[model samples]
Target: MAVTIEILIIILLIILNGLFSMAEFALVSARRIRLQQMLDRGEKGADIALSLSEDPNTFLSTIQIGITLVGILAGAFGGAAIAKELEGTFTVIPEIAPYAGIISLFVVVLIITYFTLVFGEIIPKRIGLVYPEQIAVKAAGSIVIISRIFGPINKMASLTTDAVLWLFNSHAPQDPVVTEEDITSLLEEGTQAGVFNEAEQELVQSAFKFGDREVTTLMAPRPDVVFLDLEDSFEENKEKILTSGHTRYPVCRGGLDSVIGVVSVRDLWSQMTAGEKPDLTLLIQEALVIPEHITALRLLELFRTATTPLAVIMDEYGSVAGIITLHDLLEAIVGDLSTVDEPDEEPGIIEREDGSWFIDGMLPAEELRLLLELEILPGENEGVYRTAAGFVMSELGKIPIPGDHFVLNGIRFEVADMDKRRIDKIIVSKIRHRGDENPDEKTDNHTTS
Candidate 1:
């Protein structure tokens, strides 16, 4: 019966103001990494605080209503108390008491507004943001109570917000993509926090670069590829198997060009115990095939989908260019192939006592680039070439003879070794002086056939 309209209005304002603060806290609560960290450390309320933040509208509405109610109560109590204190001093005319009441009311309201804005809204919001995960988890228990108290109001706010967004033709993405850069950043952070070593970080970064690499970059060149001749006697195949040190070999009748199927060591051993000549046809498993032009990333996907372990890489003419295995692809992503024998193509940077570089002839262009940190290797052309020798022959536009030391760019190349068709070994050294003229700069100075 004693309740005044002023008291009611103050109560409503306090509740609304509180609701505004709560909304802000809820919206940003979950994103607070600090709060999440606290929650992870077994903080009782921290987890709840983060959960409340996940649906900010509900938490915010509830808090806003509660704070608004409290703010109004503070204003009302102050105004009434002040009016009572001033009653005799300012009430010479009874009508003057109403104006005094109005002044007291405005002063109390302003004070309450200042404190509420500074402490209740701004301070809490700032602290919550600074320690979101921790704050959310700690506030989780309280947020639940607030949610229950203002359930209807929370629902209304959420519905209204959703409707407004829908009207604007805006919607949140489902299953947002985690970008390569995001993963890299996370890995970098992990590295800084000692979760990963330098080598591991480099490997991860290289794995991401797999998309730009082709199958040939990691393939065992055709010369180094081990295969079982279909025409060879069972004993001969067994001898090849024992000496070759391979778990799997292509079953080729003529050469790599006629590779029909892949023969596994398991199948070979199984037949050897049976006391019968192992039939090449019966022993071979279907070969997983791919083209040389296929990107290593796509090849990895193909390996996953097919559930096959090996793929024979061929050129456009259908000739087998090289062999790639699941182990090769894994090595591309992780490290060295564990089971596959290192191809006979050992391109070592032999630091001889004479101070001359004795680089292996069978060295791959990629290996050369990696070791020398040079960018001389050409990209994939429509030809079946993978090694430095293949690259040199490609550049020369003819078969490279044994006694040739061609200088290109600032790097000098001496033919150390050569086979019938390709250059197997080459020795390269960085020249101190600019060669006669810049190869790229001279209009007609580019090396010709």
Candidate 2:
């Protein structure tokens, strides 16, 4: 009967140990943001859970104390009680009688340790991890009460830990956590595991890179920007405006540097249809001016605050650098926006039968990098230049004329055509290494203007 009572007490201690283990794991793993969301939704015990999580050290100290005490008591009472009961059974074997007490004690210790480790620790921890929020909320109130009861001991333990850490010069520093990289890594792993499809992975990766992009990297270059001279009459520029296929055009005073404002095609069309001479200055709305070095994320904010669809990018010297529209910024986040009009000319990138690529110089270096799968470009100076032409110019230290060629990192870059001053077309081919007999080469045929 005494042995039965002892066993029951050990079983109770094991259960208590499991509870403390569960509470500790659950509290540590529970997301505070998720708890606050639950609290906002009027979920029960979420507030308590959040409060406990905020001062985790105190509540965790309480759990540690409970677990330690239960373990000690279980080992002390259980080992002695079980060994005493087993001594009678060992006495029947006369040869082993001399070592029976020690043998019984060892057996009892092993049984207690195994049950405590499996049922009390491992299983409970797994359960806590699986249902952290639920277990944490349920355990929060009890742990808070227990912590208050053992406040003095918990305080002493915390102080001791702090003192020891200070003595060892091991103060924990709160570093800025970057969760985007972690999420990106997880998404890549998920793709490999077939949990995420190719399109889903690309969208997620694009979202992560969106905040890091600069306006210069995404903006249409100055040469590509179609604008109207304020000095030109409505009749003179009507053909250009109609053929441009753009909704808005920057109305410049003399050149791109002397720009005044933007003219919407809708306003011009209305005036033209009404048989009224459109006053260019009166029809123009003020253009939003953003620095070229500004990030795409910041550019979006400025666009929202200014309530303008298009912004003129300015260099450090106050000259017109490029132009960016709201559509361009959205494309940076969600990928390219398709246009309705089909152009008569061919696109900038063309793939040949020999597996070589014909690329346009105006394509952004980032876009080219994605196309070619190059780890790093030879002369790619980020923020200094945006396009593949700029990268080649930086490397060659001059404008590359047609037929100018160079080799970098086992890839051959040949200027196929030059548009007067700027590089127009480049032929890119891989210089195969000695032993690579048949490399599986694939090229992205897509082009960026």
Candidate 3:
């Protein structure tokens, strides 16, 4: 009965060690935001868990004390009492009696260590990771009690740790900082867990990156911007109005380089409806002027503070670069929004049946990076370029002929079509592995746009 009591005491010690291990891992691994949320919801013990986590020195000292004391007591008591009992059993055999003391002590230590390693460490740590927040909260009160019981010892240990750090001129440990990547990771988790849909996730991500995008990337390029030329005949202006089917037009005096203001079809119609002539100059509204290099986010702020949403983008040389509207900025965040009475526009990217992709030269580099699963595009940091055409040009460092092709990170990019000096369209084959068949070379059969 006395031997049975000793064995039970060893078992109890192992269990206590396991609790210490569990509490340590749970508190360390639990997300502070999650613990705070639990506290906000009035969950018991969450506050203590959060508090303990904030003071790593105290919490670690408390957990180490429990684990160390349990280990020592279990080892000493278990090795002595169990080995003595086992030695008696072995001595019954005459041949084993001589080495029984040594053999029994070894066997007793081995059994105790195995149980301690599994029950007191690995298994508990795994369980703690599986439900860190809950386990941390549940274990917090007991840990606090233990910490208070041995407060002086833990305080001494922490003081010693601080003195050693002071010798090195180091600062105390700081709380982990939450960054944009952390929020993005949580958003991805929320997406997988069905709390957010893919589109919703993309919108949030786009909004986060909106401040980094340049105005030139979002504007309608000079060649694409239709205008109401004041010098043109009435029939010519009417043809521009009918053919473009757009709501707003920049009223230029001479050419695209010289812009006066913006005229809206709605403002023209309102004049005609009021029994007045649809005078172009009379209908022209003052448009906001912004530098082409401005970020889309700052432009948004400008729009918010301005009377009109239409803005004329000017390049460094004081030439008209492009035009932008509030709708364009909205599209950058939420994706393309087709205007009423217009057919659905073709997407910037289309994958062919042959596994090659037809990519528009005007496609944004950010979109290209995601499509290619690339870590980054060239000139991403310094804002050297914006579109895929700009990316291709920066890579080649010269004008590219229609047949020009190159490989990057195992993906083949070929200039499929060109419009004079500009890149009009590109054909991109999917990524190839090192050992896969060599990417087939293509002859340029496409026309010059």
Candidate 4:
């Protein structure tokens, strides 16, 4: 009986050793570099340890098989020895000896269970978690021998597990690398960890945010552009082009209503060498056109591959409404400033001290709402337009006119400038309070020109 108990304890210890080794493997695998670094510092034998640890499935199978075999060996030999001792001690009565043998076997089994469960499973797993690298190094030398002994059993177990997985329609190993959302999440984490400043973080976030942004948001609306009507004479067209100070102009067949193509000054210069009267028909090149709803990102790509700088944005009915350029897309990502010496014009709110707001129309609806300190502009149309003028124009049913004024949350906006065909510069001012009249408002002619 005593001999049986001793054997059971040895089996339990062997099982415990395997469990500890398994835990070490898991920890090293989970954090390979950390483990390797620790090993380099001479905590223990890291290279040999990590070899088994790196392959979790193999390590786990080997550990379980090794422990079980050891436990079975100890139990079988020890049980027989215990049974013999019990029979000798009880002597004489056959029934007494048999009963004593059974009791001894039960006790030995109970002891083995307690020792193996506590020391083998719980203790080592905990220690591995705390000092994984150290434990992994310690167990390095034994991992290979243990693996070899259990290789056949491990294969059988693996086959069974694979069969079960197949029955449930589980996927086989290889999964594709990185998703868009995953990349975004990683950026977000980097932001939180202070790896990115606010502007840099915003730039990354904007890349994802504006990838789906439509062409209309970045386009120069029709109202703000200077163009030559198809019927206009060559001299008249030349005058308009020179005065507009633009490198390119959109030429319509009849008027603004019949946009035919975009014509560049370079094209015009090339045509001048032909010595004809500079025919307007020959000046136009085919317009690279897209629906207004097409995303700016996609539009930018089309522009890149086509090698065209300008793309005409069209409405649902295929009428030219606006244009977007490569510069516009780039500015959307990094912002625009011609020189570093330029000062930031307005900080918090768009004040009425000056005639125009040097503000980005593409500023978020929430931000615009907060800056103006008004709730009149509902946050429903976020990311729809890039600027306040565009938002107002969209709200006003698209054909916003010059000298038109509207009140949003009691703030009055008068059209100050239109870039191309769209609202570009707007003068926003608060309405007069009941008791106090604004001095500037009264002097400046509240009547918008």
lDDT tens per residue, model 1, 143-185: 6787787788878877888899899987865653457897899
Best by lDDT: 3
Candidate with the larger lDDT of 2 and 3: 3
State each candidate's clash count.
33, 0, 0, 15
Residue 170, model 4, lDDT: 86
lDDT of 2 by residue, 126-152 (tens): 999999999998998899899889999
When summed lDDT is taken over every stretch of 10 residues in candidate 4, the lowest stretch is 439-448
For model 1, what is the error of residue 99's alpha carbon versus the real structure, in angstroms, after optimal superposition? 50
Better of 1 and 3 by lDDT: 3
Q: Which stretches of candidate 1 lie over 4 Å from their true place?
A: 1-195, 305-308, 337-385, 433-449
Query: In the order shown, what is each candidate's alpha-carbon RMSD?
Result: 10.4, 5.8, 4.7, 12.7
For candidate 4, lDDT tens digit of each residue in 1-449? 57757665676665666564555545554456666677678766677665665555666666667666766666655556655655556656676755776776676667656766676667667667777666666676666677777678887877787788889988555744346776678678988999877788778877876786677766777766677887878788889877666677777867666778878787777878867567767767777878877888888779877645878887878667887777678877886645332233334235546433444443444446656676546434555555576566655555566666655545666666565676656656666664433424422233332
Model 1 misses residue 350 by how many Å?
5.3
Candidate 3 TM-score versus the reference: 0.82
Instruction: State each model's CA lDDT, in order.
Output: 0.68, 0.81, 0.85, 0.65
Sort by lDDT, best first: what order? 3, 2, 1, 4
Best by TM-score: 3
- What candidate 2 gets wrong by more than 4 Å, as runs, is 87-99, 175-208, 230-239, 276-282, 302-308, 341-382, 401-418, 423-449
**Global local distance difference test of model 2:** 0.81
Q: What tens-digit string does per-residue lDDT give for candidate 3 at 1-449?
A: 66788888988998898888988999999999999999999999999999988888888999999888997788578658778888988888899889999989899889988988898889999999999999999999988898899999999999999999899999865645687889899999999999999999999998988878888888888888888899998689989888888888889888987888888888888888999966898877888999988999999999988766789999889998999899889988998898883447678999999888899998888888889898887687678888898888777677898878676666778888898888989888865655532344332222222
Ranked candidates (TM-score, high to low): 3, 2, 1, 4
